[model samples]
Target: MVTLKHDSHEHELNLTEVDAYMVGKGKCGVCEMQINEASSIYKCLREDCPNNSLSLFFFLHKSCAELPKQITHPHHPQHSLVLGREYNQEIVKLTRGSLPHLTACKLCSRQIDEQMWNYFCKACSYEFLLPTNAYLHIFTFSLCIRCAIMEPAIHHEGHKHHRLTLLRRQLSLICDACGITKENDFCYSCLPCQFWIHSSCAASPATIKLRFHQDDTLHLIYSVPHMYRSFTRHCQICKNEVLKDKWAYFCEDSGYFVHITCARTLLAYGENEIKHEAEEEEEDYAQPHPDLLQFPLPSTDSLVANLLAYHQLKNPSTITNPIAEEPVIQHWSHEHHPLVLSEKSTFKGDADSDDDENDDILICNGCTTPILNQHKYYQCIRCNYFLHISCANHLPIKFPAGKCLADPDHSLNLDKLEIKLGRNLSIAFCHSCHLPTNGFGYRCNSCSKLTDIICCLLPDKIKHDSHKHALVQHFNHPSFKMYQNICTACLAPVLDGFDYRCETCIDVQIHQHCAMLYPKSITHRFDSHTISLLYPPIYYKGIKYCEICELQVNPEAWLYWCRHCDQCFHPNCIRAWHNMKLGDKIFNGGIHRHKLTLVAIDKDRYPQRIHKSLACNQGHDNGSSLDVYLECAGCFFIL
Candidate 1:
């Protein structure tokens, strides 16, 4: 009797038995793929019979046909049969669709089925959605929910010590990573000189070329250990930590691997161009393999535009027309008050109080803030518009670095800046927002800072956070917009923008209006949570939050995180998104990576009511507030 060892994670099957053996011609009883039938093909007359109880049966020649079989169906207890071809073939044909178990093709990633005639294996009544999918089940595995109603046990051939049993008896198997359950069945053994195959074993196409590695296509082979020995958790295509192992995209060169479902195509349908300067790079002379590392380009249009723009913008010609001229300081009123333009040294009675009359004008045109000598400065001649050099430049700092980009027009070349003082240069950008300005900056001849015009207008009250009640406009308060102050949501300094604020609660205000993307479109993970459109459609019944993304939300927003697990999505997030019921499943392969399990509570919405829960990774400190560190400290700080 052949013992089975399919369930064990270890590969205990010996190398000698798995490879270099062959059997006589026979149709694959499962997928019906023809093998050894041609007269020209060689046949091996081995000792194993076609009807052996082993997961896969074989016959070297017809030696087993003469022997009497002593096998009885284990599950049936009464159905006994001889070891010849007639008895096994009759039993196999009679129980085709009745056999509740099936497996998938390891190569094409298809599933087994019995109900669909078109997909059913014609040779035996074994139904399978993908013909190639059926071939991989070289070792027997249980069929899906539809087929598992009848089979007693699932089996494998190479590993004869352990038995593999399906979880929940689903024809589709769950991948450990990302948790997607599907099928990829072939069980192969590469012995020494010749490869072994059960007469019932079907053939799968030996080569596949994925989109990413279109340049280097690959052929399927069992030579590499990492390719087939064990399951993997990381996505081979993206190098991200999420996916299954059975059905992998194999690189033919060294056999580097990837999960088939996660790998995406990176080929352009049309001719692609590369940016060139005075010369172009020579074409590579080495042969490109189909299964080599392939980086997928963005969509076709994006790739073209990116290539075109990259080349075009490589060298920008200097602007022909000069910027608008700076106005000479003459008669601009400070508020409603009649403020008069004066020389650099002029001040009220304070002029006499200062001993240094030659260069002691400490007044600033922006906010009229007084600056000390240590603050550093630039002085406009006509209006006596002096500025604190440090106050002239600022940047919108995001936590963890690199969320926003510096506007090309606004960012200045620090190497070009002079430190001392003078007006030889013309323009500069704002330090806080990096917007452009020219003429009256706090003139740093050393760093050439405040000699720009736009530095003449830094507003006081602004908003970048969400807590501000009324949209705070430029306030007359000169001391506003200082350090240790930021918008409530993003926590960035409120620059030139209207902010929601209250007089008593200036600390809280949300600016950065663009921060909120289309709120009307939301895809959540929970069935109990409902994402919805606020315009024409009103409130949903009991759903309060999204099921998948797990965001607690209001039902009547512009767009909301809809509660669903399978294929729910926000209209704006996806182009041409269709309205589907809560439990709708999508055939389009987008968002397949998300496990999207549904539950009332998740990490996204912990403590439903602010009660503390212990941290999974980092244990709790005494009275450690879970709410404080629930979300990542960076984004959470904004709210």
Candidate 2:
């Protein structure tokens, strides 16, 4: 007796191998394809079941019966794909923007039928379309039966010089046909020429006719012609610069060029005609009226009026804020009087002020940072409300869809973080920084996600001194699943919050605060000279040890170094000792009855006592004692 688990069956089926003649003419339960009379099949042997009268017999082809319940495909190697037959439309719609390619088979670039049994990552589907407050790392994948069982080795027309062999190892390389670097566990490669191509790219048609170019049929070309290299060319579909050395679909008659991946995406979606119509309508609508274009005399008022009219027609709430239009504007924090922008310092005394000595300093209410006298600021005439010019300008009325990283699919409006918090929740945390804030920030009313002003102003791409390549900010990228969530700079595990990752170096990732906010140079108590932030590739003769931590410092990792003192220190060590003082009292009820005073154990004086008493159960010691310990103040007992 054998148990068979099938998608259509509610219970496990007792099955036995039988000829097609014994099961009669029927389709295979797995593939839903016709079964041949000569082929062997697995048939349900449960004849005593209560549902037997309803004729609920299961039949599967011998090959289909041998299919693994779960598989790890090359396209999505982050998670194992389980065979399933359910396709929820609501889940697909929510994740369409992030995982647009999931609608089709990742290998063949063909649309997947919702009714057919396919392989999918169950974990990704569950959390892929979660709200912005939750992590948004989703890379849903679906593979049809045909693509899953494709031949391991084949002679592709794209690379006719050699027969490409399938390599089932995760690799990041530029596909020869698409000219795009994609990380995949499976790719056909010609080892001799180091040529690699995606399965979809290799199977792409030799020629394709797009609705946008109905008059011309684009033929796949290995390289751009020398005649076409006379001038700069861009892909007609993507509008990106086309490399003359890479393979692309080219039309010599109309001189049209399209990227292989872009062509495949358009063909799979079949949106070329709809996109063409939309583009045509947009072009016609963009043309200004003849009456309005006839006159050249126009002031900035006309532009503002036109914008107001457009916003009123589209969304009246968007243009209701008059602060953007006026120089002296009423702010949400200080609504008593309109704040006026000024270049000079405003030293108006506060209501509780008793002295003029501290008037030189001014704090911006927006970020709670001291505003420099040299920079412009916005100030209120009657109150202490003040804001830096940069902060004042940074607060946009609303961020349109796809503009803000907090919620790419939805528009976020500028609102008080406190207002967005639910009644049960007392605090609101920024999606980017993960810091609780009550100040002004962007909020998505739909998801109730808030992003602080500081995070909202962060740029999409940043060139950090630690890495040679520019690090792009990712909200919750799927690639993070492949590597540990450890920041390379600080060497700390960042379980949550946004990160800036280098696309070229997949492992090179840093926390957003570590990349932008850390000080370049600092004065440590242990070192006399200023310790500057040191990048990788230190040409030291021997292994360098941190002066503070007394541990080996990795030369390839970023650290704080004092060139004058010839000392190195880990960034974490310096941060730990920044505000630390000896004899600090700590209240830990679990360890002691009273407050404990922080004290250092001198290795030279009490080496044996420290080794015997303070060592772990295994009695392991490094024989270096700059170690700090807590002493109970009440009994004077070392802890």
TM-score of each: 0.22, 0.32
lDDT of 2 by residue, 29-53 (tens): 6665433434556666666644343
Backbone clash count for every predicted candidate, in the order shown: 96, 0
Native-vs-model 2 lDDT?
Answer: 0.58
What lDDT score is found at residue 151 in candidate 2?
A: 63
lDDT of 1: 0.29
Candidate 1 structure quality by residue, lDDT tens digits, 71-175: 433322343322211112222344563542333421232444332111122223333343345322122322222121223334443234544332222234343
Tell me the lDDT of model 1 at 409: 25
Off by over 4 Å in 2: 1-330, 336-364, 367-374, 378-386, 403-407, 419-425, 477-483, 519-531, 537-639
lDDT of 1 at 13: 20
Give the Cα lDDT of each candidate: 0.29, 0.58
**Highest TM-score scorer:** 2
Cα RMSDs, all models? 25.0, 26.7
